[model samples]
Target: MGFVCNGRYVLEPAAADEAEKYVNLLHDCMEETYSAIADPGFMVRRRAARDESIEEFMEEVNGPGVRCFLAYEVPRWTSQGGLSCAVGADIEWDAPVGLALSSLGPHEWESEMPVVPVVAGTRDLSQLYTRATTHGTGLGEALLRAVLADDEPAYLWYIGGNERAKRFYEKFGFQDEGIFGECGGIWGVPHGEPGQPLQTARMFRGGVVLQ
Candidate 1:
């Protein structure tokens, strides 16, 4: 079951109808985080590309072994007709404020760095984003915990120069393994200026054993 965090946000698995909304929320968060680093025109093109690939994205997220979680801000309670309304009665959830997406699969790096044998069981965190306004409300951690609550062998990548993201993952004991490359080379999309490419670095946490 999904849970509430900070008494103001509810975290739960994304529903089937949320695919498009998830994409919109994802880009909103990306714009907030990477607008300074990404070329303005590139961002526009990427948005178009994402729109065209919505179906693909949905398929991947809903694919077997994948887990996607969404977090919504809790609305305030109201009284009606001199009666307090039930918390879950007709409550409308605004667009999601946060998302965490992960999948269990063989470890694979999308860069030219020599490929390594795939681990039998690896949970790769594909995406995580929270609107800037939701920062510090405990929404991000709640989303993260939904996907990865243990110190398992897992991996993820973060855009270069995102110190806030770096610190957050570090708090979870994920270490940078010195792997670095252009974002486009790894993701097959021009997420930054060709003149000054957006770089990404991988972080990994390897501990604890699967039962």
Candidate 2:
């Protein structure tokens, strides 16, 4: 059976009826982690509509090329209550070569750039509500290992300035691949400013051998 990690909590996957709980958990995690750094007002507005968003997430999760996992604590008989932790990953698809090429327009070229395909992954480890309680256990590492086991030669991006997260990724053998220049400009998201693109790092693990 698959397990989800939230500090000391480990939860098994249940039915969609528990969607609200998972959604709330995700909102909390996002709020604790990214909200302070980014726009908390925007996050609050989005979190207010999390129920509807979760429905969409469920649809996409059940769809092709997507996988979701949830973790919870197994309580002892005398324990107060149990909490949950959730994480997920999405498989990458080939965008049209034109689209990919267009996305990379006007970027400096490195002579020996490695084309490691990107896969999306997320975790809610920012919430310290339950983290302090669980210590020295390998639950977090175990969850990461599970995700890595499923996808070999996979890469993911982490926003810069999150030094703690950067170290976590490094422990898993991911290296810093530098910032993405055209991401904000091309997407029109306006993260910081026109020229100050979001600092990002790409980390890869495992190897794929071709016959």
Candidate 3:
């Protein structure tokens, strides 16, 4: 099923190749959005993953437990180039992205506390740039609704410093679980300065059913 918001866009499951595009699109989105808020170099170093080929990225994406979806235009173009949004769930294990961030000690948490018993999901809403220019609209809320349609308890980590993102996540009923220390360096932030810490907030949605 798909949702058309404002009469110009649709949200649907992303095709395989389309999923790859969304990854690249996210890279671009991070570049643009982060640059506007922080230094350009900071954005590139922190959010853009380097040295991985598209095929490798795709393989990583298709690995066990990963699912992705996209929000595109109604009349799909040859390019299918519109806002490419995605949500990935790491079911039984943590994602590579998650693992890498956790490896950087000092900020890492020691948990006798097992991994949170919940699905972890991430939605790339910043990819709406192309569609935004064409339609003068944004479907972040729509895409988010689609991503959360499963009704399972899910969570995402937001860079503690990004107020805008924190606000966005709150609109979806997410609340802070705790500071996800050393976790925000997913894309390699405070680059090359290994010990530099980034703050993270673990936000959750849906309530636990007592059954």
Candidate 4:
């Protein structure tokens, strides 16, 4: 999918040409994200298990119905390397400060869907990351709108305690689907003591047309 976008960035679909660069950008994004809200213990474990995370990212990037749009800080052709096939502000940064990874979910979330004409199965906003330094810039918004315009009835698992994220996502119509308990285990964080709050929640948006 492609888009006609207006902003400092021109978004585009990522191609195999951007594969290695994407990996580099992805790690950068992950490091920033985990830094903000991840448990210290989990961070230690994740660094040690870095290879495992990299392998997972590779699978998702190549998997069914997944799309990645990179936000570039400069024009697409600024590189001697070839990413000629890329188009739209999936924003492409030669050293990207923002990335949005999306995938179409396998199952229906009919109960969760509203009247909007969203992608049939849920579209997962699997990862949305912007470098901390670009926090005030519209880089995140530009990257998000590019991906959302292409797919919707979207959902994501946002880290808890991020009021900024919650507010940002709410403006785009995502609603809290409730906190998730399994994230502690999923991220390799030790289970919280009884009644302790965990840092994961599911949020959902449209895709249910009620046909």
Candidate 5:
């Protein structure tokens, strides 16, 4: 499935060959996100992990039961000499801007999740991210909608300090379960600062019947 959003981006199933582009986008987005809450040196420490994400990304993209979607920027056209240009005609996709990865099942980190009553048959939203430059252009929302079905029971984890992400999920009817857990390493960066373990909370939404 493919769709355009806000005349600025297009969403489509990610190609297996685009692992490098996907890793780069994820690195930039995560840096922008964690820089606000993490120590200044955190990104420096995360460099090796960021560089190594290509392998993991490739594995996941080609892994079983995983659906990965990518968003590409749309080319902008302008009229010449004050004439109207056929803006939407012959639209060309520019560059990759965002990505979302979802999976059914027992994810790699499921065992690490805080012990709680787990929801049965829930889809795991493993990742949803967009370049910081594309924020507010509805790129993130479009990518999210493309990955998960409406009224499908699903869950995702958010970093503790990322209020923006928490609020975004809330808009889609996901609620925080109040189960907090600490991750020593996230995306290959260790939360080594004393008393500052990487904080996380799970957010869930019920399917149609439960809703």
Candidate 6:
């Protein structure tokens, strides 16, 4: 069972049929959040590519290893309605979002050290973007906290140059692991001008272990 946040939304695990819908909403979050750093052409191309890859996206969300958590705006009286956001992850295999998705297994570093399962699509699931918004309501943090409210070690890929993301992850004790990657470059699809690559990095910390 889960509790209400923001006086209306319920945070809980997503249903089977709902996985695809969540992935679709991922586009909105990515576009809105990364819009400042990306050009219009890139956004358009990305959206189109995502739409065409719905099957692949759905497979990612519904993969056996993946578990999805979602936020929805249910009537405070009854529990049913608009799907607000979602976050999903797989701790077993390679995830469609470019994560190796494993814990206690081989890391990309060519070593056998155990790694933490990656939290997938959390940034998208933690954000609420309605047309009637005037400013951030801090509700995203609530959604994010719902999925990550744990002591077990988990990791995520934080994009470079995002101070807000850096600060948030820091609050959870996720520190830079000194591992760096490119936006699409990790998958060999580098964006930006030849010399200007979009870089991201790894951050790890023992679970926040909130008292």
Which candidate achieves the best lDDT against the true structure?
A: 5
Summarize candidate 2's per-residue lDDT along 23-53 as a digit string, tens digits. Answer: 6655665455554345335455557677686
Higher-scoring candidate on TM-score, 1 or 2: 1
**Candidates ranked by TM-score, best first?**
1, 5, 4, 6, 3, 2
**Which ten residues in a row are the worst by lDDT in model 6?**
92-101
Please write out the lDDT profile of model 1 over residues 1-211, one tens digit for every residue. Answer: 3545535666778765677888888888988988887655656766876765567567777777788988776566332311233345343465788889988654344534433433556787888999999797677777887888677678777888888999998988888766677765323444444646667777788752322
Local error of candidate 3 at residue 178 (angstroms): 3.9
lDDT of 4 by residue, 153-188 (tens): 777777777778888888888898664443544364
TM-score of candidate 4 on Cα atoms, chains taken together: 0.68
Which residue runs of candidate 6 sit more than 4 Å off their true CA positions? Answer: 74-138, 185-195, 207-211
How high is the CA lDDT of each candidate model? 0.70, 0.41, 0.44, 0.63, 0.71, 0.45
Report the lDDT tens digits of candidate 5 across residue range 86-160: 334344433577889987655557567765535444577889998888888777888787888876788888888
Worst 10 residues of 4 by lDDT: 109-118
* TM-score of candidate 3 relative to the true fold: 0.58
TM-scores for the candidates: 0.82, 0.56, 0.58, 0.68, 0.81, 0.60
lDDT of model 2 at position 119: 24
Candidate 2 Cα outliers beyond 4 Å, as residue runs:
2-8, 14-17, 77-136, 181-199, 208-211
Which of candidates 2 and 4 reaches a greater TM-score?
Answer: 4
Model 6 Cα lDDT, one tens digit per residue, 1-211: 3434433444555544554555555566566556665544555566667655566545545544444555544332222322332112212211111111122211234222223434432221222232113124444555555544444465556656666667876776777765665555222234463334445665666642211
lDDT of prediction 3: 0.44
Compare candidates 2 and 6 on TM-score and give the better one.
6
How many angstroms is residue 54 displaced in model 1 relative to the true structure, after the best TM-score fit?
A: 1.2
